[model samples]
Target: MDLVSTSREALRIGAVSYLNSKPLVHGLTALEGAQVRFDLPSRLADDLSAGRLDVALVPIVEYLRHPEYQLLSSACVACWGPVLSVKLYFRTPPEEVQRLALDEGSRTSAALAQILLAQLHDVRPQLVQLPIGDSIDDVEADAVLLIGDRAMQTSDDQFAEVWDLGDRWCRWTELPFVFAAWVARPDLPVHASQLADVFDSVRDRGVAAIESIVAAEAANLGLEPALVRDYLTRYLHFTLAKREQLGVELFAKHCRELGLVEASRSSLEHSS
Candidate 1:
């Protein structure tokens, strides 16, 4: 069926357009009763909260922000260490940094940056939101937070210090960090378990098609295919297993301590 026809009857699923997400949603459109659409990570959270999307790959922090939403699948956009994609470029040392320009496409990364800066570095910079494509020169910040494609494309030498939040979190807590997860709204038109099965199947297919996904996305993002493949296979952790669940709980604990989210501890656990 065409998009218009699918939009009305199928479950609306929000897909991220970043290269990191390409593998997760590969061949997802081929799934029946599910209509996939693309949007930024932050927008997906908004759409899901507003009831525009039945399910979405939303920022992990969004799940904490909205406790009513149920995690729909075992697949996630996660990382164990040094995720080259989520970076904080700083011209000044972490403690001296007083201002930060944030990527508008981020919600989880932005909040994670805050948590890290406050607790880890003892710094509380004023955050200013900027478009994802905006240049670092556009705002005079001591540090800048970039996520997704833009973060991947950035060079390390451009900044005095580059802090990968994933690496930092892993080193500090020795646990994987879940950046995004597939979550469904409280009241859905479709059954939650059925949605989970379809999404899990799609995730498996997507992971199996990694080579094709890397080749196609490399051309679009202007990156080397080998590097893209390594990043996908090595850096990006897509499974939400026991350790990943522990990561979510730890992250939620930090978020709660920072007063960033109102969710209870159990809300961080993925619902089967």
Candidate 2:
């Protein structure tokens, strides 16, 4: 179907509001016929599943539960190494983590933490869901999983061992880990190619205007602009390519092996 003829109604777009996500969604609202709403990654995934969002920047693991959804091309929140965000803060070694306080904001990161522990440490810790914005200080857990802005706030003084999941995945699998990607529902009327083009264009513009983005985000998050710039430029990867797709598949395989998802067990199919 022709993209122009697909739909004239406003498209409901789900976006992650984190500073790390700004690049992919920058100027997205400027696109014609698009209505953008921002929320946490996990909420976005729920909205996508519940039909509240036509498309969403959702966790990669969300796709395994709904393989019928189409993954948009050339846009992702990924990292080749050392994402500097999405971290596991532990007072003990990875293998000795007895109780874990998990951030409910991102299930993908939570799953990644589990996958890493199981594969690398052979330990299965008890999981406790913790609310966002509140510190894990009150939670009685040996380790805590934090993502997005909170993860960036972590320092060596706070934890005996801080594991950057992106760096760990890269070192362990030698593949870029895709944290999130734009996914469209099977029945959405929008044109996939047109949507992909819109997202890619937004990403390019966002990266080009990194200085302004850095300044704004730094002020908003109370972080140094230089740090923000380094994070955006050095850590986060926006492109979803062949290698990234393979990475997603590998992640799915791990998820399945650990019984994290059921629907993907037979299909093993993912949108490229």
Candidate 3:
């Protein structure tokens, strides 16, 4: 069915509130027949699963967990290398880490940290929650995983070692890591293809308007515009092409092996 013609109620869309997601949602508010809400990535996943949202830009791990979810757009939050925004600060060596504090807002990064540690060092640390607004000082773990703006701003001087999960993943696997993607719940009132087009168009426009996004968001995050610009343009990758698809597949495979997510019922095929 054509959503614009048949649905009187606006499509409920959930998006991440982090700076990395701004480009994907830049023009979303102005789109007719859609209502956009911003929240933490994990919260968005929960909302989408509960039927509160028709679609969401959710963490890729969440998408892999839900077999019914459909890939709605090719636009995503990915990194080819050195994502400065998703980091792990280790107070102990990787092999000696006994406990890990995960950012409350993250699911993908948390899972990625575990996967990396387990794969490289054969260490599986006990997991702990690092509540939003809580710092490394508050968590009495061997390591802490932080994502989004806080990850970029937090000092690493107190830590024994730091790892940029994205950079490490790329160096280890030579593949781009997809942090988040636009996914729609099953049985949507609108055509999936149409919705995908809207999302892709919004992403293109947002990427083109990176300068404006930096100018508007940098001050709010207490970061320099130059840093924000480079973070968005240089460090982050938005398109989910062939190599990114391979990354998603590889990530899902590892997640399944680690039992982080169930065995895949279907492949993550994107709408063209």
The models' CA-based lDDT, in order, is 0.85, 0.85, 0.91
- Candidate 1 per-residue lDDT over residues 148-168, each given as its tens digit: 888888888878899998999
Worst 10 residues of 3 by lDDT: 1-10
| 2 versus 3: better lDDT goes to | 3
Where does model 1 exceed 4 Å of error?
A: 1-8
TM-score of 3: 0.97
> Which scores greater on TM-score, model 1 or model 3?
3
Q: In candidate 2, what are the lDDT values of residues 188-262, reduced to their tens digit? A: 877677777777778889889889999899999999999999999999889877788778888989998898988
Q: Please give, for residues 189-258, the per-residue lDDT of candidate 3 as tens digits.
A: 7888898888898999999999999999998898989999999999997999899989888999989889
Q: Residue 164 in candidate 2 has what lDDT?
A: 93
Model 2 poorest 10 in a row by lDDT: 263-272
* Candidate ordering by TM-score (highest first): 3, 1, 2
